[model samples]
Target: MLRKIAGIIFVAGEEGVTLNELAALLNLSPTEIKPMIEEVQQTLKDHPLSPIDLVQFGERFLYVTQADLDPLIKNFAQSPLQQKLSRPAIETLAIVAYRQPITRMTIDEIRGVSSQAMLQKLVSRDLIKEVGKLEAPGRPILYGVTDYFLNYFALSSLEDLPPIEDLALNSQTASEELFSLKRWEINLFDQEE
Candidate 1:
């Protein structure tokens, strides 16, 4: 029962498990489980080699790093900062992420510049790829972001992409306005910092 309780607590991680919740799951009353939880806590406390401790916050019990190992644990668990993507690359990637299975010519038209170099760089980094060819005059290659792109951007999936404000991007005027607003927003953010 102690092992089962400890296993459930460990699996719960930071969210933790309440005594009442555990009792309900195990078909036992809270009173019956209190001693077992106390035993688990004492066993963990008595184990000199153990790097974990059982802690309670309000009615919840959870596993936490033992006090003495905080620095080592923090150092070992630190996540490195991701490399920053270039502005052009980000813009191209955003377009691909939002308007996937799109052609390079269409991308160039949207950005009002050639996207050949950016596309090549994105493909090389495995962030974007030539997914297929558009069935048109020359059968221009269609580009889309890969699963790697989602990972690189820390996105669960393409659906996680932020909604493009004012989706009426049928005209170049609307596109220009959107980019201008975005640049203005960036400036405002920089000023706030």
Candidate 2:
């Protein structure tokens, strides 16, 4: 019972909570807590308001907002109001969305100003996050749009962005390009069509 309550609090109070933190709060080793939570997960497997589930990231465990919870689990789903972005944050977001996993240096080069401060703000808001580090000197961190960003933008996927090729092509040219690419890949002598 206490584990369940502590788990709920750990998830509700922050964007994410590591397993070490959860163990400390529950007065158990992470090893013990792991299986306990798995059991708890099973109990709530059929629950309606219990849409919240544990997210495992490497060795860490955190409670993340699950979009599936929605109107059914209103109380848990009702996130504290999100912070609004300044104009600069919005612009940076656009660049990352279109060219994701982009390094901070590249973002600054494109925007003409260092974006450290704005990037921090966006990270805090959970709209953008460190996807991974670039395999370059100093292993600079790469930023990318989050699932939350896609949800906010109402996009099915990044590919849904208006194709740049479409913008540059007239109808005839666009049709010709598609036909050429299709024929170029198709094998004329293949047994199957």
Candidate 3:
């Protein structure tokens, strides 16, 4: 029973499981759930080969991969032969990374196109995920970069990303230069001729 509870928590990921919620789900009391959680924590501590830990975040309990294995996981996630992000996917990732907790509609607004496919690709790649929903009218889903994003980029935190102001300035300069090109308006149909 304890192991089953622990497995449920492990599968919950960052969302976590509250004691009350677990108790209700398992048809047990809060008191009964507490000891089982402690036992699971102890088991995790005693098992050297186990790469997961039971952690408490506020009122919620989560099973997260041990932090010490981040480097190994990062390496595995970034192998060259593994899947790579396309230009649009990379751009979408950058937007989500910077303007985190943003809605898909906002992402589309910034990119000047529907980002549904790109967002789906990023989510499938585990670089971004649906964090929560906005409290507004439609209650749109909010997207955010995952810990894997930091690991893949070798960033200690989001603070380590280059300044947004610098990025904006560089982008503006690059766009101006691109627009100044004499052949910028070249017709695609000419190539087919």
Task: Give lDDT per model, in order.
Answer: 0.77, 0.66, 0.78
How would you order the candidates by TM-score, starting with the best?
3, 1, 2
Predicted candidate 1, C-alpha RMSD: 14.9
Candidate 2 per-residue lDDT over residues 1-193, each given as its tens digit: 5466445547555555566777787788988777776775565555677756666666665665466756656753333223345567666766787779899899999889999987887786667899999888899999998786666556889897656487347456633443333322312123122
Per residue, candidate 3 scores C-alpha lDDT tens digits across 92-119 of 7777877899999998998899999988
Task: Name the regions of candidate 3 deviating beyond 4 angstroms.
Answer: 1-81, 168-193
lDDT of 2 at 45: 57
Name the weakest run of 10 consecutive residues (lDDT summed) in model 2: 183-192
Regions more than 4 Å wrong, model 1 = 79-193
Off by over 4 Å in 2: 1-82, 164-193
For model 1, the local distance difference test gives: 0.77
RMSD of 3: 19.5
What local lDDT score does residue 171 receive in model 3, on the 0 to 100 scale? 69
Clashing pairs in 3: none
Relative to the unseen true structure, what is the C-alpha lDDT of residue 61 in candidate 2, on a scale of 0 to 100? Answer: 57
RMSD of each: 14.9, 19.0, 19.5
